[model samples]
Target: MKKILRVFAALAPLLLAACAPTQLVRNKGDAAALAQQAAREQKLANANHWVLEGKLGVSNGQDAGSGGFTWTQDGNHYEFVFRTPITGKSYRLTGSPDGAELDGADGGPQRGPDAEALMRRALHWEVPLDELRAWVLGLRAQGADAELSFGNDRLPSMLQQDGWTVTYPLWDTTRQPPLPAKVFAEKPPYKVKLAIQSWTMQ
Candidate 1:
C-alpha cells in the first residue's frame, strides 16, 4: 500500500500540470503600442468628410485599367470620379445612404441599392468601396475582425480583413493624423492599387 501511494503521489503533479490552462504572455510595450494604435484608428474613423486626389489601378488577372481619381466624402454621401488618360474618358460613382449611381459606363447611368453591386454590374469591377472608405483613412473596416502589422514608424504596414490583404507602402507624415500615400490591396486574381497625390479635409 505504501509503494502504491508513493507512485500515485509522484503522478499527481504531472497530471495536474497537464490539465492546467495555458496563459499567453504579452509584453507590456506591445500592449501599450496596440492601445495607442487603436486610439489613432478611432481618430481617423471620425474624419468622415474629406477629399482625396489619387491614381487608381486595378487588375483582375485578365484585364487591367489605370486612372486618376478624386474621391469626396461627406458623412454618408460620397462621390468618386475616375479619369482615364489614355481614352480621355471619365467615370463617376456617386452615392449616399439612400442609393448609389454609376454614370459614364458603356450603356448609360445605372442605379442600385448598393455601390459594390452597381459597379460590378455596370463596369464589371470588383472594387470594395465600402471597406475602402475606412481603409483609405488608415483605419480598419467594421463588421469583420482584422489582423494588422505595423511598420517601423508604428503605423499600419498591412491589414488583413474580409478576405482581402491591404498594404500601406507609404504614408504622408506631414499631415496631422498622417494619411496613406499608397494603398495596395489584393485577393488572388484581383488587385487594386491607389496612390494619393493630395488631400482636402473638411
Candidate 2:
C-alpha cells in the first residue's frame, strides 16, 4: 500500500507540472490578445468619425487668430476646409494617394510639389489619426506600422512617425464619444503647443 501511494504522488506532480506551461501559455495568450483587441478598438474609434469640425488658428512670428475648420477623411481621400473668422472665407482642399497620380478634388492634374505638400498637410495626420481610425472603425490599414499610447483624455504632444509629424488639438472626440484633448506635430517653434481656446469639438 505504501509503495503504491508513493508512485501515485510522484506521478501527480509530474502531470501538474506539464499542465503548468500550457495554462501559463494560455493565460498569456489571452492577455496578449485582449491588449491587441483594445488597441484595435481605440484605433477604429479614432478614425470612423467621418467629420471633425472646430476652430483653426496659426501663429508664426506673431500671426494668430480664430477660424472655423472642418476635416474629413474617407477611404484614401481626405479633405480639409479652413474658414477664417476674420475673413469669413473658407478654403476647401482634398487629396488622394493614388500611386503617383496624387489626385486632388479641384479636377486638376495630380502630381507635383504642390500636390504632395497638400496631401502631407491633410489626411495623413502623422499623429494617431490612423490608429484612431483603426480603434474607432476596427479597420486596420493592412501593413500599418505605428506604436501608440492613450490618456484618460485627449493627449497633448507631438506624434512623430517615419520622418513626419503633425500637431493638432482634441477639437472634438467622436462621431460618438472619444476625442483628443490636444495634439501637436513635432515641428519647430510652436510644435508642442495646443490651441484650446480656438476649438469647439462639436
Candidate 3:
C-alpha cells in the first residue's frame, strides 16, 4: 500500500501537467500588420494548389444538412466531392471560373453557369462555393469589403464580408502553410461549418 501510494503521488504532477490548457504564444501586432499577414497568406494560397478533406455542415432557416467533403483546387479549376449522411448519397461538383458541373447519386450530371446558383436550385443548399475557396484560405473573397478581428496568433479569428461572418477557432500548425482545423460561416438564413481533417498542398 505504501509503494502504491508513492507511485500515485509521483504521477499526480504528470497528470496535472497533461490536463493543463495549452498556452498559445501569439504573434502580437497592430491592425496593419495583421492585415498584411492575411494578404500575404492569401496570395500564397492563390498562387498554389491544394487538396483538403473535411466535414462540412450547412444550415438555413428552411433547410439543414451536414456531410464529409474532399476539395481539390488547382489554379482556376476545382473539384468537390460531398458525401451526406442524410440521404447516404454522394454528390460531385467540379468547376472552373467559366462553368460548373454537379453529378448526383442518380448519376445524372447537371451543368450550369454558376456553382452557387446551380447548387441552390438542385440541392436547395445556398453556399457560395467560389467565395468559400478564399474564405477557407483565411482570406476575404474578392469584390467584398471585409472586417477582420485577429486572434493571439495574429490570424483572423473572425471576419465579416459579403453578408457572411466567418469564425476560425482551430488551426493546424504542422503544415508549411498551416491551415484551419475548423471554420464556421454564417449569413442570415445560411450557415456553413467546415472541420478540416487533412490538407495536401502543391
Clashing pairs in 3: none
Stretches of candidate 2 off by over 4 Å are 1-49, 60-66, 98-158, 162-177, 190-202
Candidate 3, residues 49-153, lDDT tens digits: the string is 989998776655554556679999988999999875544567899998899999972438989989998888777677987678887877778888988776777
Count: clashes, candidate 3: 0
TM-score of 1: 0.83
Q: Pick the candidate with the highest TM-score.
A: 1
Report how far off residue 92 is in candidate 1 (Å): 0.5
TM-score of each: 0.83, 0.44, 0.78
2 or 3, greater by TM-score: 3
lDDT of 2 at 165: 47
Could you give candidate 1's per-residue lDDT for residues 72-97 as a string of tens digits?
A: 99899999998766556788999998
Q: Go through the candidates in order and give each one's C-alpha lDDT.
A: 0.76, 0.38, 0.72
Superposed Cα deviation of residue 86, candidate 3 (Å)? 5.4
Candidate 1's error at 5, in angstroms?
Answer: 81
CA shift of 55, model 2, Å: 1.4
**Count of steric clashes across candidates, in order:** 0, 25, 0
As for model 2, its CA RMSD to the true structure in angstroms is 23.5
